[model samples]
Target: MIDAAEHRVVDCDWHYQDSFTDIVEYMEEPWKTKYEKSNWDAAGVKQNLSSFFPTSTGDRQAYGKIEREHSNYPDKAETPDRVREGMEFLDVDQSIQISHLALAMGGVQTDDERTQAFAKAHIEYMLEEVLDPDDGVYGLAPLPYSDIETSLEILDRVENEPAIKGACFITAGANPPLGNRKYDPLYKRCEEIGYPVVFHTGGSGLDDYVRAGYQEMLETHTLGFLESNMSQLVSVTCQGVPEKFPDLDIVFMESGVTYVPGLISRLEEEYLKRPEEAPLLEKRPSEYITDYYFGTQPLEVSASPDLLELCFDMLGTDRLLYASDYPHWDFDSPSTITDLPFISDEERKAILAGNAVEVFDL
Candidate 1:
């Protein structure tokens, strides 16, 4: 087992997936009955989520990567014992249990009520099976991005659950981006409770741009997943989210690092020219970007060491968090991320664990 007493290593973007049937076992009362009876709204929402992110696929022609976590029923990937075993194997201290079902919910065109019900059921399962009993595991509370009130209610219900360290919502399908007035209540509440609002990777934003724009699955999958973060990060920094909730810590996960510096430079130049348009911004856009934390996954291997060093510098050495994207085929080992020759030991340690400890307030 990895000795937590000596070194701290937190996998910031660990994932858990389930089919629609697996989720029903965790639901209570009305939600349970709805799933059992196949209530059109609730059942339909669950079906879509399950189909979108299954743990295993029969397609041999499946995209580039095919490796996935073992899918033993009951003792599946996200179970407490399984997580403990995974951390031990990976030499990690803990992992933030992010919901794959919740990630799919962001882009689905579903009723607000139904989505909220699904979100609650998903979180219920996460708390029971993956988070509550495991000290080495932390959770991100899934949010129904379609309805703010229901999301708030989920947070209220899970407030005393200390294992839930952050709130997970997707901005991929968000029309107004995430900085609009509609999401103010959530930002405010998260700030009050000292929880960081994490914007994880999701897909099919704004009329399914990726699918419509690209022909090949490889083409769409590669670019589609990362584009949403760029747009939303711009919206949050440029639209003055930081100014309104100064202490609200935000995270961008699964997105690569190159675009961050490019976008910040664009925003910086724009700020110098059009300061009046975005008056809510207190400092330059890059400073706000610095205040946020980002995940190091799908690492920018194409970049030379010098370029990687420059990107890390722009990102602020302490701001990047290391993630394995574990159990997925593309998962980077903690060593692969930390073993880089260009970075110092302290920088690698910060990326591996110290930064996550501060960002999640673990």
Candidate 2:
């Protein structure tokens, strides 16, 4: 059992493993053929390593790290024992493990059969690792973005699974904006079932600016969050998805909160410039943003405390959730965030646990 003190803190953003081997292991036989046809062998591994760890010496060192860390599943990195260690380190009560590969890879094949199979495999893996009989772990289900009908069906299959709290989608990489009419069926299903939709940045199989070149790594990693959030917010607001499904709750994960104030201000500015474009909005763009949820990391905690106070004051306690982003190179350690010089006890409590309870209904 989780300690009562620890149980009260909810980690809003965390990641699950997607080892290269796991993908090869879980693929269906026919799909395995397709996967193998792609460059998933040694050459593919080398290419991935080169891209993620570009420096010559750094890449060599990182190859060992990646192989050591990712070659096995339920290994030290993903074991419940290791997770408990992290929970203890963070003083967190419960954690939601969002799948990095599952969210990154949407619509493996455009056809319905392949997409459904892919989605099912992902859900099954999530259930096996994080959900099955585990007391404190929860999961966000991955939908087949390739086909809406299958996506809705997958939602229906997992909606009642107690271990599943939400559905996750790629922040980018889907054909149209998330608010596009094609996705309304999925949103409507989520609303009816009362599951929040989580949009995680850095999708798989994407060839965006970030994935294109080495120079874009710094800029890509920084700007990806802003770009995806802006695109999603604008798409949902301007396209009337919120109006269509007011009860649907969406959380933007891994994107820091510093730029949000500016985004909201800019959105309001654009709304005023062309009111007709956003006729469905009942108030300013910031109002809807305040209604939505955001997960906070250590970097976001670096924003001026005064500005942070103002933004949270407007967004209210329920709109922000705490996330440690554990195990990644950029993982935010709990101590670092909790010890930020300017944050108050009350705000710390809220960001660490209080807000997540309300947002996740834990």
Candidate 3:
């Protein structure tokens, strides 16, 4: 248990999700029975196809390594009481409860019905058990981009739920990028309704390019999370998703902040050369990035802290929210951020809590 020096700490991203069957128990259909009756999300019942392609759940994968070796089981570790204990230890005044297992299964399901049921059931369980406390554990609803109607319905259901703050669409496959016109409805609705979408992705739902010739979990874990977020980051900015929905605020989770400056620079370079292509873009690509926030987990540990120093100086103190990536193997905490010699006390306080309160309206 680490003391937060009495600062108002806001953990922007926290995972409190469990195994598939845990969410299945909340389902109201044949899907619930199917999960309980037959082992779903397990070996043989449903194999981890992509891991075989490179590294997956059943094999030497990033997440499986965390569970098998690190002892951080998503379902078992993430409970209201358990999370409360973590929050207490970290002195987290507010945190956003984001889903994982269900979203990871977004496109993996051979049966769409199971996917739909799992999505709804996961939301139901989070709303009741994990996110129901209303004790600063803010619910960030997971909206499956693949299931538009169900996603919309879930959004409408939680539109006014007090503790419900934002929404999320997992980014694994490039099939339906965030910039796709089909996802316009979800984005438009979130903008109108004032729900910030905390976009997250990694390991499981990856594009074909990611797994090509890939061999080890280390390779994927090190790069997979960044690759997934980078695609969405490029899509939303270049396609002018931020400009179209000016109110939308997206917090890119897990992917470190160091890459953002470079990505923005490249985007600006392309934008300047071909401004005519993205007519909807109102300002420099970097400006739109400020409209978004970022989680500080897997904190950048460079031989020279100057790189991390440079990234923060470039991005400023507004949108970099503190995140522990709690219950995961690569969790970051107060010491990680606070001990950064480059971060001034003012900026440290802002990252710790100030920025999150304003962004999430906590």
Candidate 4:
């Protein structure tokens, strides 16, 4: 077995609760006052109208399909101390924290100004309240996806903060796709600042898949992540995002690694048939894909080891980063990678730590 003690294990993708109640306090005048006054409470229930996140899980908890039990200790991973304890338990040296509530910010929030305000409040809350680079906890600045100018501004705002590692582009319900020219400026800004643009997926039960009449939350939750990232992969690759910003680093989170090899093969097959369509791409789609990084949370470990080993070989072992997705229902532990019989000790160490260090410049 690969020894977790031998490496400064880095979790490239982890999530924490950015509750609206707490984030609202950091909002500016109009929004703060508006949210506070509009926030409603009842005998045994409460709701925040200003919450940017949609109610994606629906009535699963009400029916006992899911349980929300209280923990003996801090379980949200929302504070620096809680995060440090989590890292210790998982044998992780460093972690890049994503927001559990804000993961759907881009897809769910349509109001441009509200999106900007929420993004700002989230970054402010994380920077001031949660993030502690010295304690091995770091975060990505959540960007307002629709507002390019504000996104660029946020990038500049967090440029000097040591705990702010990169800009997070939520991809759950990205309209016009990520490869469009609308996102080019933000991508360019990321490249200029040496910050990788990490695309994080979210549950699609609230809007996209539901609107299409998909009743089951399980169906949407299972397929939503894969579909969202696959859509962007096609857009980013075909539109030559890598070519346009050669130095820019890209990372896709939440989705498992299995779809990558299949998607790349499909893209290459189509690219060969019609090279005229994607004129900007100088190499095969798979070739450019190998340059990007992917987080391995919700990793499909139930699959056959031989199949996984083949997938890893196709994608290159160095491109994979171990992500715990801790504090969530389906989080992976360090043993998930360490116990893999196919990967050698060195490769396991690289996946668990080394690749993340190089990807995020840790």
lDDT winner among the candidates?
4
Candidate 2 per-residue lDDT over residues 26-123, each given as its tens digit: 65777656545554444223333322212111221233454433233223235445666666766766888776555445424343355455567667
Q: Estimate each model's TM-score.
A: 0.86, 0.81, 0.87, 0.91
* Candidate models: Cα lDDT each: 0.72, 0.64, 0.72, 0.79
Q: Which lDDT tens digits does candidate 1 get at residues 39-158?
A: 323323333344332222122235424544442322232345666777777787888888755665667665535567777887787776668534678888888866888888988977
| Model 4 poorest 10 in a row by lDDT | 68-77
Instruction: Count the clashes in each prediction.
Output: 0, 3, 4, 0
Off by over 4 Å in 2: 1-7, 23-29, 36-80, 106-116, 132-134, 203-207, 210-216, 340-344
lDDT per residue (tens digit) for residues 147-257 in model 3: 778889988988888778888777666466777778888998898788888778655744333555666656666677777788898888778888778778778888878
| lDDT (Cα, tens digit) per residue for candidate 4, span 18-79 | 66667777888787776566653321013554254465644434345334332211223255
Model 1 regions lying over 4 Å from their true place: 1-6, 28-78, 204-207, 210-213
- Rank the candidate models, highest lDDT first: 4, 1, 3, 2
Deviating ranges (above 4 Å) for candidate 3: 1-3, 40-70, 74-77, 106-111, 205-209
All candidates: CA RMSD in angstroms? Answer: 4.2, 5.0, 3.7, 3.0
